[model samples]
Target: MNIVSQEHQKSGQQPTEQVTYAAPYVDIEPAESGYVLRAEMPGVNRNGIQITVEDGNLVLVGQQQPLSVSGEALHRETRQLSYRRVYELDPSIDADRISARIDQGILTVNLQKAENLKPRRITLE
Candidate 1:
């Protein structure tokens, strides 16, 4: 997995765009038919997450918006930020059949193996 870093640019006294990024932890497990990938992305909503597979890479982007409260807080620990992680996909992966879902701050992706790559058992009579 690859972690993309935050980028900065300036143009003639314009306000600099401050970006805070974090890489969510991930786990990949192999199955008989495919692989299961799970990522921990706390504070990310449905609209705040994006998953895309392109150029033999699976990319995950998640964002956490700032909390909106009426009163000021005495202490603060959370910050609005974005999360990005990328994984290089092998030729055995069937990208067209890949599926993903998010629940309870966790993102799960099912990566199906290509037909020829799946294990097969042969019987001899």
Candidate 2:
């Protein structure tokens, strides 16, 4: 896993745009077949989260839009932040069986091991 402070991302208006990326806290739970990856991205909506797997890497991204108000600013703390995290997937993980869902700012990704890698009991003939 890698936590990047800033990264260059492409935008429609600008060919290259510099973005501040924050890595969200993540917890890994080990299971029989595989492990469950849970990422905590507060204030991020379901549509704003993106997950992709490519080149033996799993990428997670979260975007939070700036809050709008109809008055002069007095005190402001919360700001728009983009979260990104990348993890190197194991060889036993079945990329095709990976699935994810977001609920209450928590994104849960289910990583399943390939059938060939799973343990099985053999019966005596």
Candidate 3:
């Protein structure tokens, strides 16, 4: 019958394809003293993230794993995500003083400005 043939065709179809998402949701703000960067990375822990400064470029690399589920269902969707971002640092930034922390699924990176970069008071002679 037509119904039986349609059911067989549907069953023959392949499962849903997996997808990988890259991290691009980052916010950069310039404060009076330094620069702050906030990155949104859910389901990622501090151990999975890596930050490094090399050759005047700041790089952020991390991976996000898919959630696990129990019980079999009619349909399912799961995917792994990874991201890497490179930022060119300004000469005024003190790379040695840069620090980063992650809290509640948000990663914050603070880049301190060198003492020379700070505004200095100018007095007339």
Candidate 3 lDDT at 77 equals 50
Error of 3 at 43 (Å): 1.3
Q: Candidate 1: where are CA atoms >4 Å away?
A: 1-3, 6-19, 121-125
* Model 2 TM-score, all chains together: 0.78
For all candidates in order, the CA lDDT equals: 0.79, 0.83, 0.73
What is the Å distance of residue 77 in model 2 from its true position?
3.7
Worst 10 residues of 2 by lDDT: 6-15
Off by over 4 Å in 3: 1-21, 71-79, 122-125
What's model 2's overall lDDT? 0.83
Best by lDDT: 2
Candidate 2 structure quality by residue, lDDT tens digits, 1-125 = 23475433423354354666778889999976799999988778888989888788899999875666699879876545778998999989999999898888899999999998888899999
Q: Which residue pairs in candidate 2 collide?
A: none
- lDDT score, candidate 3, position 44: 71
Sort every candidate by lDDT, greatest first: 2, 1, 3
Error of 1 at 96 (Å): 0.7
